[model samples]
Target: MSERMIRVKDIELCTESFGNPAHPAVLLIMGATASMLWWEEDFCRLLAEKGFFVIRYDNRDTGRSASYEPGRPGYTFEDMADDAIAVLDAYGVKKAHFAGMSMGGMLVQIIALRHPDRVQSISLVSTMYFGPGWEELPPMEAKVEAFFNSMGEMDWYDPQTLLRNAVDKWRILAGSKHPFDEERVTALAERDIGRALNYSSSFNHSYVTGGESYLGRYGEIQTPALVIHGTEDPIIPYVHGEALRDSIPVAELLTLEGIGHELPPAEWPAIIGGIAKYAAL
Candidate 1:
């Protein structure tokens, strides 16, 4: 794998790629408050081994990307969506398949609607539909809600405290089906915190503003889509995936039974295989 920084507008985004550029490109966009590291290096390599040019990048305010004040974010979600395009442009990839998790999935939806020509396909993971009818879906799980509500109490400056809170957050997100791997999660949290330009800045994602409403436009998307959702997902319920599959003209759902809002290593093979099949089409 190789890493590089690409300038987009006034800020820079750090990106990493695996496999040959000649292969079909598959861009992986992680969720809010997460850097590209969340994609997991071994997972990327496994996907690349399936003959794809896999790419993962840090969203602004995460990893080595541009950051803003803790409570203030200079850009909007629209800008973040465009940043994905900038990554594509920088790599000379005119069109590529996109696999996004959570907020990243929302960005993929926006890109497919706003810039249809640049997208070949999209894989939505642990994310809800951005258009109409989302309000009627199941709300966040109570435990998950409580965890997010308590985030303000965390002392971001204390490494140990941050690590503890990060692990706790993952424990809630991993659901009951799988055993919580505290050591693994802790190591990843440490890596994320240690490699960031300003780890606290990642919280700026909570303040991002100004994205044009995609209301009632889910059917407008023409690109083929794969909606992957964990049945036990606390953040985005399984019904959201069903909504996407039903609303989009060319979309299908892949349910992960007994899974939660996370992409655990055991699920990588299934997820990667699903994406590879969709990309081939």
Candidate 2:
């Protein structure tokens, strides 16, 4: 894989590409506050090996991408969707299969809704169809409380604190059947901390609210879609994935039996294979 900065609209996106551009492209978008690295390098290569040119990039505020204030981002969610299009434009790809996790999944839905002509297929993993307050099904009360309480205690000034927080958060959200890997999570947190801006703009994703209505527009999506969710997901309930499957006429839902809100390392093969098959068809 090769990494570089690509200009998208008025901002520059840090992007990593795998495989030949000549192959069909699969764009991966990560969740809120999470960098493109959340998609995992090995996972991208596996997809590429499955005959896809994979692209993963940091969204506006995360990673090595452009930085913004920690609060209100100047752009809207539609603009976030457009950022994906901009990445495609830079790569000279007119239409490509898209996959997103968490907030990234929401962005892909917008991309399909607003720019149908530019999407070949879509895959949403561990994400909800609805925007922030509009989720069809909300997460468990205890989990929600845990998330907020943890965030409240986080010392954003110390990157080490942020890394520790991430490790703890993953443990809470990871699938029960999958053994949590402290070492791997630590490595990812360390890498992200080194590259992340001093003041993170992750909260900006929640502050921007215009896309709340996009959930109502799922009926307009005609592209083939695959909705994958963990049956035990506590952050975004499995019901959210069911809602997406029902709302999109052509969408398919896959439930991972013992999984939670996270995409565990063990599930990569199945997830990547599912996306490749759906996109290839």
Root-mean-square deviation of every model: 1.1, 2.0
144: Cα error in model 2, Å: 3.5
Candidate 2: stretches off by over 4 Å? 131-136
Tens digits of per-residue lDDT, candidate 1, 8-86, equal 9889999999999999999999999999999999999999999999999999999999989888899988899899999
Candidate 1, superposed: residue stretches over 4 Å from native: none
For 1-281, candidate 2 gives per-residue lDDT tens digits of 99989987677889999998999999999988888888889989989999899999998788888888888688888888999998999899999999999889989998998889999999999877563345336656596666767686677888777788878877788777878889998898788778876436866776766666666677789899999999888788888888888888798998898898787779988898889889977
Clashes of 1: 0
Candidate 1's error at 12, in angstroms?
A: 0.8
Query: TM-scores for all candidates?
Result: 0.97, 0.94
Task: Give the Å error, residue 176, model 1.
Answer: 2.6
Which residue pairs in candidate 1 have backbone atoms (N, alpha carbon, C) closer than 3 angstroms, thus clashing?
none
lDDT per model vs. reference? 0.91, 0.85
How much is the lDDT of residue 238 in candidate 1? 86
